[model samples]
Target: MTTIDDLPIRDDLRGQTPYGAPQLDVAVRLNTNEHAFAVPQPVIEEMRKRLDAELSDLNRYPDRDAVALRTDLAAYLGHGLGFASVWAANGSNEVQQQLLQAFGGPGRTALGFGPSYSMHPLLAAGTGTRWIGSLRDPDFGLRADAAVAEIHRHDPDLVFLCSPNNPTGTALDPAVIDAVLGAARGMVIVDEAYFEYARSGTRSAISLLPGHPRLVVTRTMSKAFGFAGGRLGYFAADPAVVDAVQLVRLPYHLSALTQAAARAAVAQSAALLATVEQIKVQRDRIVDTFRGRGVQVADSDANFVLFRTADDQKAVWQAFLDRGVLIRDVGLAGWLRVTAGTETETTAFLTAAEEIL
Candidate 1:
């Protein structure tokens, strides 16, 4: 009998941990940047109503292209961002993969700014593409000069920009992003997974799509739309680019149930907007609380706050866990990230931090 180790594996995946969020059981969980609220009753009822209608079709495969959902998504985006075209996947993660499949492959490179989303490199690896992470400045802002120079040097096939980025929770400057875009010879994918939580007037690269054929902006319902478990995300790009993603996507990827659920959520955008407002309030309060206690916090435009602690980051994480709180220990060595939850949970997190710090 052959031992398992004797079997050949993909050379690229010899020692890789696939992309995933942390899983932990804690009373006041703030680790994964999930929305602190549930889908509103009206949205739930609407979903149930649509599901009732679609249950008859469960015996068959879902619409291969999810055309109706796409139309609804376009309408939803038009209402929110004043843009009318959109495409989607099971989650933004899948959308990201579709992007790689379209524009990146073996020998081509996927470039990303450092301390941004962790998924870019992992996805690139899985696609047999080279991944390059360029470090940002100490404040987590993109170094426009270095980035432009590197883009010219590497000439990557794809570049990922996570605005109001993860872990550090900072947005890339519009001017800097524009410079990189100008210098890039390939597709630029901007992940706006935290858009709703960002302050008003924060610029979105989506607005620049008309002039940039190589740009795509991806958004997720998991963060601000309170649909993490529902696993829905969408992207807006040039129709040609959207067509490229359509080519690589699996058949019937979005189930009828998921379509119903997403449609329901989109139909009730007002409620989601209200909840986003509340989360922003809580987020601002958390940032203030951390600053008052002398904890250096990143100026976040997302629903989470990242702070630096002089104490051992691992020790701080353990202390929070020991106190029934759960927060993400980002790889920044001395930094940790906590999501904005309900008022009570935020208070508990503060209390736990007070003890841990």
Candidate 2:
């Protein structure tokens, strides 16, 4: 009876598709750019103790500001950053949503360099902000001068810069950030979701926060920290900018259990993060092996590699899937992304590629 066009929905959302990666059943899944390692047992035990302690207060609201968690996050970041300069949410997606809500909406505009993070435009649209897709170099690099010129052309209310960009797996040049901040008249958000995996000599935008109040640098515990299941992400900005987001965030947004779990994870970060270097080794090995075999592999500072296939990307992806390995076909014509998984997972993918390609 209700099979006709659905009841009233936002005019902007009529034909929109939700953002997601395929969740398929496979033996070796290297699709989502997740850390290949498991959380250390000691960290899990600590989180269990913390969560068990919080079970008694289920009736009461969580710390609305998540002050203790923020303090720990501040300490973890250690760029002279403090709790007042930090904010946290369910994940980087939620953190991005809060940002768009605070600074973007009807009559506002947000800009992102094309092929960076797909979620940038999606989140802007969800917030009712006009989304402008800008350009990048042929190699997917965002050069500073060209980037600054585009910022001048759009003059949007908000801008997004993704370092170690998704689907491309390359780090941004710090100068591009400086140029955008200088040329743009509004808020600039540098999404550093993969910052922890960046190669040496890579600079973080958090270092630029001392004087620039308009910049926000977002990070997550999902990647290098091995806390994806915990659903924790955060950002660092000026105290004033941090306070502005409070105008839009739901009261008691983070649950007590989530906060406790994240706190325990952060406390054991050293042990949890020891796998980063090991993962990096496998990542470099992937690049070298792929390139040596004549596949075009993009230089990567992130924990994944974006390689160009000589054959159809869909066919390649499916071939990998058929062989019990899963990687992302990011819709680039000749490209696919593979997360830097464990040594065995990496070997399985390479072995599959050798046979299939």
Candidate 2 Cα outliers beyond 4 Å, as residue runs: 1-4
TM-score (C-alpha) between model 1 and the true structure: 0.95
Residues 39-96 of candidate 1: C-alpha lDDT, one tens digit per residue: 8888888889988998987999987777788787777666343223578898899999
For model 1, give the 10-residue run with minimal summed lDDT.
76-85
Across 124-162, the per-residue lDDT of candidate 2 in tens digits comes to: 999999999997888888899988888888899999999
Clashes of 1: 0
lDDT of each: 0.86, 0.92
Candidate 1 error regions (>4 Å): 1-6, 79-84
Q: How high is each candidate's TM-score?
A: 0.95, 0.98
